[model samples]
Target: MSAYRGVRIADFTQGVAGPMACMLLGDFEAEIVKVEPPGGDRLKDHPGYSAWNRNKTVVTLDLSVPADLAQAKDLARAADIAVFDHPPGDLEALGLDAASLRDGAPHLIHVWMPPYGTCGRWSRMPPRHSLLAAISGIAFRQGAHGDSPIHLILPIGWYGQAVMAAGAMGAALYERGASGQGQAVTVSGLHGVSEVGGVVMVLDQPRLPRGAPQGASPSYRLYQCGDGEWFFLATLFMPFFRKAIDALGLGAHWEVLVLNPALALDVLEEVFRSQPRRHWLGLLADAGVPCAPVGNRTDWFAGDAVRHAGLRLEFDDPVRGPLAMPGPPARLSATPASVRSLPTAGPLPAWGPPQPRTIGPGASRPLEGVRVLDMGSVIAGALAGAVLANLGAEVIKIESPEGDPFRSDGGPFLTCNRGKRGLGIDLKQPGAKEMFFDLVRQSDVVLDNYRFGVRKRLGVDYEALRQINPRIISCSVNAYGDAGPRAPLPGFDPLLQAEGGMMAAQGGDAEPVLHTIAVNDVATAGVVAFGIISALNARRRTGEGQEVITSLLAQSLTFQLGEVVTWEGRPPAPSGGIDCVGLSPAHRYYECQDGWLAVAAETVAEAEALLTVLGTQADPTDALTAPPEGPLAGRLAATLAGRPRAAALDALEAAGVPCAPCVRGYEAYDDPWLAENDVFVAWRHPRLGEAVGVRSYADFDRTPGGFRHPVPDAGEHTRQVLAEFGLAPERIEALLAAGAVFEPAAARSHLRDGGAALFTQ
Candidate 1:
């Protein structure tokens, strides 16, 4: 049985974020009642809309009218959750706000996706996905390098918001099973966008630097081959660098190039260009170095690997003919996720009580009875642990005696390792293997994000651990997936961005830019968490355990789902998005007197309305479907430039045209909306006192998630963890004396305040 089989959602969201979140719930077998506006939800046939809106029953309602408003309120009263992207007062004006809903339906989870969250000053200001990206400083770091800003042609910010919302909703659903209550949940485009870039997005009072125009190191950047095709390298650290040099067969220039990265690019470029892309790929693959061929949308969408991996879904719709959408990113062994017919209404699969199993006792969180042993490193692995912790799993993070290599990475580490007890033990030590196995025996699951072969080489692979505890589920994450030709090669987030065509699709004919944010890593982390949940659910159906796997490749595909495709004879259709200068003047960025802003007219009616606002006689179709740069684009830009951002926004919004100003940099947190829900809060840290941190983007009725303790110092819980695991005090002391494990100077003060049991139902 799916986790949310009997749950029902009242979906009033029209655009990307809310619909996407509800769609994910639908995948988990939740029933969705999607209430669109009278004309139907916008972007109806658009790939993103169509794909996400699957498994939903759509109905139209005009909340502005008394009758329709009453109808929406009725749905809200009956639903387990209500989702909407309406501004702060829209529902209240219609007498259906959270406060009103609480009065009538306190058990309903009211999810609101405000632009900046319910912060102070800018809560009411509108936002488009590009505007969110711009405010995140992504566009500036993505290409313009701070002098000017450019928008990413994709709706990443909006998509990320949806993922965060879905995660929160899942946790809330679990909590509701115990509490029989629901609370208001909030996710802002601004908060979601910042989190997608957590590696660079600081959680302290001050922020980190955004981007370097030229990459910090040539070895880690793009290199073009003889065919003028760029292939990314896997040279993030010393081991990877050694492997890369061995594969390239480079000699004397290694030292000079490694020390002097400014001079490395020209030398490496000339070296790479000596061979065709395929030759280098072959060499890298053979030597266990990560590299991939750069291609256009056609090249990526038509790849054999994607089809084999079930990342592609094809269905013959009666009205829309053949339809293909990116399939669900995670795969489960027992009760798999399926794409159901939109019109079908039937009883969900029969789900009985789960088979009993042993697990550690937990505090008042959703996964209270679950115990997880986290042997993960870096962004993807560490983040998966954090997500699990949010659900009330007792996560014991096992690191080396020297600590996780990424502990000093600052912001990323702080963001991904918060809700866990830390134990530092050297896996290379004599008794380390037995100690790890003992923990595994007690754990319900063990998770890691090491390279493809590391676990096997260390004798801690699934096959080895399952021998000790037959009911243990092991989840592993890697660069390329499990069993591929390129599986052995290591992967980094930026490298995947380059290999996945994000740069090419982003830059077009211009110089390709690397997104400074670690989007793929963070996104993949969420998918991993989802996989763990699915596996746990599967265990309920069958008294067994299994290995679950996900990869960066899967997330990259999911991220660019709607925009990427292969069309016959179109030569992959340039690089970026729909040709906005010619075909979508109203859907691209435009400059006002003071700054740039994003606007979109996805439908003909909206285009016509925008044309009316511009007072242009030119047919809207000409601008919307032109083959070359349209005159209407210039006209719109000119008209927009004459007005200030506020006036232009006000005018466009009055006409019902979607638009927002391009906001960026530290100004990101200035919006007042976040204060309303504590979306971005400052939790006290013992070391970094009063450091900034974000609460889970979700707010629950019961068992709401927050920092149980400050981020732990190395080995913060070593003694406590050993004692809890039934290890003798003398044995622990001996190990500590032998330097096999690390013991901190003192127990964390934060942990002294009840630690993992901070939130109770």
Candidate 2:
């Protein structure tokens, strides 16, 4: 059985964030019914929809219309939890505010995916992936200083937010089972990205010179091999480097180069250039230096390692033939995630009428009765919990008395917080801490991403809560690890890009640059969420839950460890920049009138093929002996200046030389081959209209997968939520008057059968 088989979700979402949350749930076998506007969710056409929107069903209703609103309320009423995206005030207008929803469905798990959230100054400010990246400082950090507009690394930043949102939803679902009462969980992408970039933000003493190359260390740099292929070498530790040197028979040079690191690098580069990449790879493997050839998208899918890892899966789709899709990264021994089927094309999948039930007998799901409380302030926390919720855990989101901060970040929030419940609680109130503790006592996990020590001051610290429930698993995520020197510093993704080595490494030898995508945030969230799930699995066997902690700083540093560990204790070296054209006759990027193609050959046979293509034969030994200096580069540049890109690529490919067009950003979206592979899907939306693009990253077999909803308006579930929480009409009035809660105007007309009266408690 899947981990989340039979799990039920009340999906209130639109956009990427919340839908992503539900997607994870769907992947694990949770029954997720996406509630949408009478028109539909907006992201049906988001680039790569086929990859993102998988394993789910969809339904639409005009929440602004009274009858539809009532139906939405009924849906929430019948669900174990409901997830939504909206600021606090908007909930009242939408008729699906947290107070109303929780009042009606006390046992529901609520998740709110939003932008700046409900309370902060920027809470209501509109946002998108670009705006978030720009405001967080990531945009400024990407690319060469004077290069094209700063944009994120294609789709990666948005996907990061989606992953975090999914994890948060999962956690909330896990917590709901024990509390017997739903709670509100929230996540923000801006904050999530910030946490992921924490390490660079926390540096007490800057070590490297500003604008230095990221891989300045000799042990962790890319080199061109004899056959023209590029390969990375990362011997991060001195011991590793020593091993490599000995294995390469360069011990005498290494001993003599103790005084100058540049000399060492030059010698090493020369030695590496002596052999083809493949030959060096074999030797390096025996030497224990971690290295890999720079791979393109085509290479990634076809590579042996990726294939062996089962990172790619094939599924049959009605519209497309066998579809190739990426698969989830985490692998469990017993209850693994599966891809049953590709997402169906057209309007959202038709969902059956709502049904209510306490429990059903079946083979156990991984998180059969786990309960979670998610109070994530940003993307990382939200996504971490969402993954758990999807695996059959009951998760409840605890919003601030004001509301979640992400309510204003636009579609991202809706995309991240689908399929859970929401509850607003004023932690500052006299009894609020007590209420929180009560909820914690009933929950198996409590997930948060507040700055270090915030939970302690707020009386939600794990030490204090463990006394109330020793088996409670607490996961705290932050920008920096708890004990680091910069642990207390606040950070966002862009700042981390400058601080972490990513920005420097990504832009080649240009200015230190950041990836347009929020890699740090997304990667950290994934790692942290994975850690939390692992802990939960261990707890199952031990009946003892422990704390799982991670930080953006730790994750980013881990990702860049190849550079960090190698550069540690080593002084920077003056750049020994490679003369690509001069280094090898067959290594070059040829420019056609319309485009460019990179061609590489690393063996004598391959070189011979290149010579045949060029219709020239110089002495092999003489060509190899040419000085790697200016004249060679100039001559090569002239030789391949105006060849047609396609023809050149075809010739190289036919000759067994590796060659490909270097595509960036939107151009990748237009690639017909990608379309042929069914990597993108088309979906119709009510508000933003039609969208056609890439889907989720991976594919699963044996379960539902694909886009189901557009991004949702804020608090789309207010009225129905309150009704399910059992709020009485008169009492709800008093609470609203007391400023305890609200629902959006759109949702207000949907209240049915005097269900608004249960919120007085």
Candidate 3:
């Protein structure tokens, strides 16, 4: 059964993010009708377009012509969904905006991707992914003071935003299937960047530790062994730290290890350098520390984990020949995601007919009948369950008696937890155990992001839960994998960034930089949500639920693959920081009269052509710093320095050079591009009046769903949620009196309780 078979998407997206969302839909057997301009999208000739546009038919449509405009509208009217990334009003000028189609094809799903959305302070300014990265503070976290913010080796902000869009679309489609209406979905690159790295901004954590650089404590960072091979230690918590100490025979220095990271690093460094990475990794693993080799892309591919997990994929394209890339970062037994070569594989990967669904009565969302017990904390796991909630799952958030620390953290919490129900309980109270087990018995799944073994410690591990309800799907999220050297240790998002080589890639060897965006955690949230959906799909067939485990370490590796390709026998590589250290002149940033801009030209001829547009002639005999660096680079740089950004952009684009102006739009509130895309909205924040917000990244043809309401105050739903779980009012009152369960705020007085209330709201 294909996950998205029979779905038809009319895509008018350009560049990486929007195209990638529709591409994933294609991977799942959705029909993609990609409408390109005369010259094609900005990346039509680029390899990425191929990577993302598989299983699709392409058509050229010049919207300026009345005939082509009619044809494009016809395609949109016929599609179950239409996706575009153009800024505000671009489609409206051509009479193809939301209002135009709403009457003719009310069932059409209209989705728009923008840099900044339409109504926010920054809505009108156009920004590329790099600028979003900088505004999100991810760059600031990537380097130390006096260092200019380093851009990531990959378009992480865009990709992360796209992944979120894919999930949003999937949910929308599912909703449409249940209902019979369609509506708009909007996702913004800047907000996506903000969500991924939001842990720092939301938690009030500094970019780095007070005075120290961004590296972790002694046993949880990169260490080079005698062979110069490097491996990472991810023991962020004390238990894992103890294991590292015991494994390294440094138990005698427990007191200093307890308080002094500097002293401990010195001691551990000497011991680590004395042995090879393999030996230390083995010993650390045996000692129960979570550790993995500091490998590049090649090493990662060669590792046993990816192949076993089906993370790597290969497709033989007739036009492009053999093309290999990482497969979907998830796996499902019954309905797995597939990849294919364009014009080669027939319909990409063919799929079995979808199994008939068992929809609940009066349902208007994809996950209408599903129930989830979200015991998630902080960012990753909570967000994962929140995805389910927004999809119409009955999610009851189980917070501690003290409340989710996040309820006080502000927007990150409110936005992430907007649609879910909340209940506060202290499992430590003996009386609460049965109540939790009761909730578990009714739930289809249980999710958490506790430290590696906290579920077991709390007697809520999969095995124990299975004893109560055999079909319960158990999912656990952590900083590191479950069975490694640092498994028992605790970790934070940026700490994982530092250990997993992202910071190193951005900041180089000086001091470990951190990407505050929690890129790993954000991507991992999507992965977790996908994994849960996959598990649910599998369980439907097997009638047996299984445990799903994921880690920040694994996700960060997937994100870092663009910068580092590792192989067996490869020596360790240092991060080449953001100053064009490893990129070609064409791929590097250049100064312009107004600001900065970036370009990419893989071949010397391409570079030469670009230089010509910049008014410089290429000199074959000139010395070059990067390979194939034509003589015109230095001269082109000097010329670009004097030209205003718009003029330079016009020339380069006319010459077909791959480039974009790096404008700072984080503070701007007016850009026609964003307004046309419908990415921004003036959301009403109860306390802040009308505040700008980004919408979810999906549109549905049937049921256009959104957050039921703004984030609830912690314990606001305690009484109501308990009543739904079959508890009598007296029982709820008794539990409240006993202090086993908590409800700090009054339940909304007027609304009928349960997920169904969202329709009325």
Candidate 4:
């Protein structure tokens, strides 16, 4: 996009989250100076390193050396942003912590990413993504049917945190343009875990039973066809569910199907198994039911949809030969993102004072005074608005008179709609449409996930909104991009998992398996939020807003960034299988005397230490690379099979190997360390009573954000929100009387007394 063309970033981070964050910034044409050790990043041996480190200048400098350290400080002083992923106190010891570096560079935005958090009990632990996932109870939650934890091959939290941190960086940059100053921010593995687990990491909420290994429900899971191929059926909404049943000629059994879904699965299964995958997919698509065939990353990467969507990028890297991978996850119309080039060799750039811009309005948080109209429903779009609200924006969620259908999904609704005030209005009603247009004129951004053509039908699409307020930034989240074979179709997270190879990868050689975590949905939220913030920053510079688009399909590819790339000599990327345990012997979950423990030994040194602790005689180099079912895993498993979880964890930690117990249930949120850091917050909901959810995704030292209020019930704040927007009480009452706007409590009588007929007419 070149939105950040003149901005320079000093990237001192390594591994997944830090490198991915810097890569996203680089994609926007920021000048990234990647500072590595004499050898390279710790992840240099990994396959995705090339993709994550693209569009940057590489320079080697050891901070332990006084001369090199001085040069690093000089580069940090000159850059607009400096990112780090060093251990808790390592940077402070080297005089490169935020305070140390920012003392001389007041305009530099310093971002520090820790494995756990800056002040948690595990703060000193190594930056191991798998271990973090294990300790946080995420892995345990992934176990289908309440079995032992499944070690996820994907670093879900890291990627989620990366996108969140990128957004935070953008917000800080925007704020700096006003205050002529910078701030320190933190996006840790804990934040990443919370980002993905927001829907489940709740206090007092009854735990949902882990579903079948294949899928969660009949209308929202994978199914096998006559030809032995599989596809996901995602009739998540009522209308889609009805279409699916009617298409299957099961309309007569609708009542029974809805009341006893488990029993209906048998009938549906028989019907689906009677046909081939192609037959079902075609039949379902014609009926408007969201479905997709199970496919691997290779097939998806080479698909026509990816090509038509302009999501496939092919380039010949000087080091990696010919390569193909997915492009950036979002589309900004005016400042469209692009893949410029690979990392180039260069020396550190010298420092100079940053140019100053005229000061703008100041606030307690980066986006304190910004107003947003959240016209989104469900996870992807709704969570994007929640993120902005958490960042200090005043977000008002606008729903139809009937309210968001997802509100019935209590936990997910609470998670995604937190921090937003709610208003229920009938946009199809002329009076309501005028009231919304008034909101558009006063709002900085409007977010939605209505299908490609639905927004236009409602007269609230980007073009429609721009006409009302030229400065209104429209952020739309869709299943696919704006133009593609799949763009017109409906989609859900599991459908993408089936279509984009996640199910295939997780299933290994067996039937396609659905990963319990909502990886695509959650990641898309972070990605869309980042795009919105970036677009806002661009607007600040150009004095105009633009359309920013993201999709579940794009995020599906993004979640597999490291593995999706194809090159002539690329090594096989790590993947999970039927076991769902892990990718390799050195980086999987092992059963102990009491419980399961996740171990991560990425380096030969760490592998050697792991073997030493297990008292196993094996070559660490060979053992680390052995297949999950190989002799090395067998030996480690045999030894660990007798050791207590705590003792093994202690020995592994003492020996410098990263490991953690697979915590179960919501107990991890109550950990003293997590509680001390306020990883979870508590508030009272209007209908659900007491509630808890993860805190904001990142920590900004000066402009920090936290839980402001509970999720609003439909129209809960209609009167108050309108008053704040300058609407008088009498006008609001007239709108309510006209049935244009509504409050559930106040409208209950009216609706009961035939006001509901207004919708039917």
Candidate 5:
């Protein structure tokens, strides 16, 4: 929405994460002045630069020059938010750090995003996504089981960082509206790992359920048809999987299929291969199974589905000419976000700070007084609520009487549902709708991931809820956008991954490879969170709330923002081959004698240093100008093949090239670098006992948040919450007796066993 209307920002950042973060705000009508250096951003030529710098005013200044530095400081002091990404201590010398600028403009929201953090063991490392991914176990997570790590072509973590920063900015603004003061916000590239990897990257015993590198499970993986075309079957939930079996005439094999997934894998593979893609897809679609044909980004760009859903944007650029790329991440029904204009070079516009907002007293957290009802199940919808919970909203996750099937999915459930209380009710029962509307009357937001019309049928759609609470916000997540032909189809992460070209891109020239990171699911959570908060910000100003919407389909394009664009004279979008080493020899993973080493040498100087370390005769400046399918890549690989991993990293680091060992996500728990930064959070769960996950990604100087509650058991807080909401004890008991409300036997056992220790660390 135009929730950020009238907001002004001084964007003193470059590269993927920082620029994308600022651009997301600009999408909603925020006025941004991008202050570039005399030579412009180091990534100015990168494909995504055009998309990331849209809807902003661009100006160039040399911070080393006194006159230019003063102009930059003036712009920062005059803005509502000042955002920058620099190595630790680099900005203080220029008098642009938070303390320096905030001294003169106490109302400016200062944000700094270092590669690691403002202060940490790896803070000074070059802000390279490859190095961050390697050191933080992202590379290892992308690798196939029993395979060497594959360097990622998609900078998913950086995108995660961008969305997290955008949300944190909204949180800060919401808080400032109350206190009439601004504060410093920090969201590091490393913090992005927490946003995307929180589910699988754990430091606990009994690791989360994992799938083969190809897919999550037999029913939820990619398959090749007889015509050689591939499609992803995404029946992650059992009901759909069972439907798929019955539709396939395999009902007789259902017992074995349910009990022995390994055997079922073989049967399903043969069954899918027996027919052409269209034939199987037709049957599956008729049976209401979720699946999509594997496609590439180039084709996806031309798809009718995207155009129909309005997820594609067309803009004319002075340099790139006519360009087409992805639209904003979320859709706001009332105050919709739009692409106003492309960034153009200009001097800073004359500006002054506006009158400060004077609202009611602020709380300890940005969303402290906000209340939310999370009716979403599984990852995308549930994780959105968890994000709001971390932002200090009181979130209650509503489940059916039998509870969310995903609750048994272990770490994934804990990851998405943490910091929220649980309530269980059967809406079909006599008094359930009355009880639900009571909670809706008091809540500010309601979230769900049901298919397009399911909410309307369930009597919880936006129209139904708005009638009950005029100020209520409704957030809906789905596989596709709200009004597309596919909007009514059931879908999941891999379905979008297949249709949006992620699988083809990641797989390169080989068969489609499904990323195990749950890229679409994780990213949708953050985006949905931002949309909900953006609506909240709008409500604060206009005294009304509206619909907030996002889908995995939108995020699929967003995750590959750089590659999802096309324009005249634009270079080919970079795609890694099956090797997954990298886009070029200078910036990729190299196998060493002991382990893998990742090197990031994109610039001429860094490329020269890398060549020198490898004793290569290749011209440094032109080394990466061509694809790495030449002798240069071969030589670089040959040189590192003889050396040990640690030695290669040492040589590269000493030569001023960024590098890190490809450490497994699980092994990162023992790394002293991350430990020194205190990046992990440990909490207890009623069912799973002690567990550790990545901490909250964004940091607010005046209002920090961390683990405040454990994962809730089904209906765990139903009685307490109902009583607190003014329901009498007898009424609650009567509802429970009438089967309108429920607490499972396991939850009752937990209470009897003194589960007070569940929320403790």
Candidate 6:
């Protein structure tokens, strides 16, 4: 049985963020009932909905109707946790909000995901994924130059933020078990993007005019291979740089370039262009510089390493015969992650009456009521602990005596540490080591992201922790792997971004660029979290736990391995510019009188059909045809540009081409197709008024449905949580007096208004 075999989740989510939280929960064996409105979730019509909405039970509710709203409340009351997305005040307006649900079910765990946070200036803004990407500067950052405005291929910022929400919800679930009371977790896509992009934001201060570019050094950059493919080479450290140069037989130019980075990059680029990618890759691998090939989605799943690692999962789906999906990334020697089955489509299956299980105080739960001591400096380890906590693990966060550096004056720290108990432990203090070991004895996992050996110096290393709890899972995250020479170097998301060639890839040939969202950090967090879960699963079978480790540098390197390997042996080539038209003449976007439409012709037959609509030659190979010099390129561009976007789209689709209009973020809310599919729902908010939200990507057939609360206020459950933890009034006061814990002052005002209470315990 899965560790979370009996857990129940009431998912009241719309769109990717809240649904992803539930998706992770379902993966761990939670009984998740996804609640939707009578129309259903908006994601059912989304391009990628099938991939995200799986392994879930779906139910429909009409919150605007009093009878249906009452039923939703009852469902929440019976659930262990509820996940939802709403603006600041929607929950209160619905009367099925967090406070009401918690009042009915004191032990319920509530998760709320929103764009921006519930309290921010943009909290009430009706922004979709792309809009969030635009507002957070992610879209703008991907422009050719720093000041330009070019959107990226996808809404990566929102995706990363969604994962953060998933981790936060998990942590909150774990905490609810400890105190026997539910707490509210509020997550914001904007804040999540901001946190990931914090380094760039900080460096952009007026005083630091030359704010750090995504690439601070040339060692981390991309080079064009002989086959016209892109290869990412990340040799950030001097030794790796030396090795790469030596492997490439560029010794003569090395000394001059090494001393002057600008000169070195120029020389290396010239040398790299001299050969095709494969030739250089073989040479570089033998010499030891971390490298990879830049690959498209198709190349990603087909790559050798991915297949060898078993990262692609094929499952039987009721709607689609053989569905192929990305497998869980983390690997364990014992109990590895596996794909159960593809998600079912349509309505959810019916579950029988609720079966509630009760446990007295101190009785162990699955994970044997394990405790996790989180000491990670940033979000990665903190998020991992949160995942474990969702599975009934108790995670205690040990912050610096001064406070967590990530607090960013309370925003980030509060967001990441929602469900975990917080204690200020000054490891630098004289007796702090003893207190730590005592805590370790009670913990099943000790997680941190400090520089590789820093824990040993602090006396909290795996060996030391094992002395206290022999079966403890000690997991460490770093910029690079723990034992490599570069392991000692200080690094973070941005640094890894540069070193892993993400910046170069994002920049293309223009200049290094940093994504507004921290892709490396969030992706690494997911990888690490998977590692921790896999290790825990192993312990169940082996009667032992072991160390699970990961690094931003390693994850980043692996992420680009496909492209990097492709660039080896190839010398650099001059820019021939993007062949956007060549990518797909039939598959390209066409402008009509109304708007733009994206047409995809994946097959030769489809390509021919699209060409017929354009009244052009119906040849699939037409895309490969080159334009005559001068006015020909301009003429074709004008012809396509002159067409009405809608008419062109209609003609193309009528001919059996896969086509859809490119709807901007805000416009997506009003799309008829999406509305027909029940992708967007309008809910009234008490404070923010009316709001429209997206639905989860996955849809299950057997569970209760929908989100339970709107976004929560900061530290929204302090007093109630403390009381549940069995702390006497005096003790609570004492701790408050010592500055050991705190609750937001606004929580009191909300309580008086019968608003949801916010707290940090």
> Could you give candidate 4's per-residue lDDT for residues 647-681 as a string of tens digits?
99889988998877777646665667677767877
lDDT per residue for candidate 2 within 457-535, as digits (tens), equals 9888778888888888788887655653546645444334444445444433533333434455556556556556555
User: How many clashes would you count in candidate 3?
Assistant: 32
- The lDDT values for all models are 0.67, 0.51, 0.62, 0.81, 0.82, 0.53
Give the per-residue lDDT of model 1 (tens digit) for 1-761: 76567678888887777887788778778888788776776666555666778788877777788887877787787788888787767767777777787675656777887765554444554555655655454455443444445556567777777777877776655455455666777776754664564322334434544554224456566677898777777566556666777667775567876777667777778889899988988888778675666565545555766665667676666655666666777665445676785433233223232222233322365566678889887778888888778667788888775466566425557777878888878777778788778888888889998888999999988899889988788988888777656566678776667766777776677556555556677788777776786666556556577787778877877677656532222224334422222126766677788877667666677678778877777776765564323566888778878888878777777887766656554444453433454545656656766655566645554455655766777787898998898989998887777666776653221221111010100
For model 2, what is the C-alpha lDDT against the true structure? Answer: 0.51
The parts of candidate 2 lying over 4 Å away from their true place are: 37-40, 86-90, 115-127, 140-150, 200-216, 226-228, 253-275, 344-761
Candidate 1 CA-lDDT value? 0.67
Off by over 4 Å in 5: 143-146, 200-204, 208-210, 356-361, 616-635, 746-761
Q: After superposing candidate 1, which stretches have Cα over 4 Å from the reference?
A: 60-78, 95-107, 119-127, 141-146, 199-209, 212-215, 342-370, 390-394, 441-444, 456-459, 462-473, 534-546, 564-659, 669-679, 683-690, 744-761
Off by over 4 Å in 6: 119-121, 140-143, 200-216, 250-255, 331-338, 345-444, 447-468, 476-518, 526-761
- Residue pairs with backbone atoms closer than 3 Å in model 5 (clashes): none
Task: Find the number of clashing residue pairs for candidate 4.
Answer: 0
Which residues of candidate 3, in runs, are more than 4 Å off? 37-41, 44-50, 57-69, 115-128, 135-137, 199-220, 265-271, 319-322, 332-334, 340-371, 386-395, 399-434, 440-445, 449-516, 530-720, 733-761
For all candidates, what are the clash counts?
Answer: 8, 169, 32, 0, 0, 66
Model 6 error, position 146 (Å): 4.5
Estimated TM-score for each candidate = 0.83, 0.49, 0.71, 0.95, 0.94, 0.58
What lDDT does candidate 6 reach at residue 215? Answer: 33
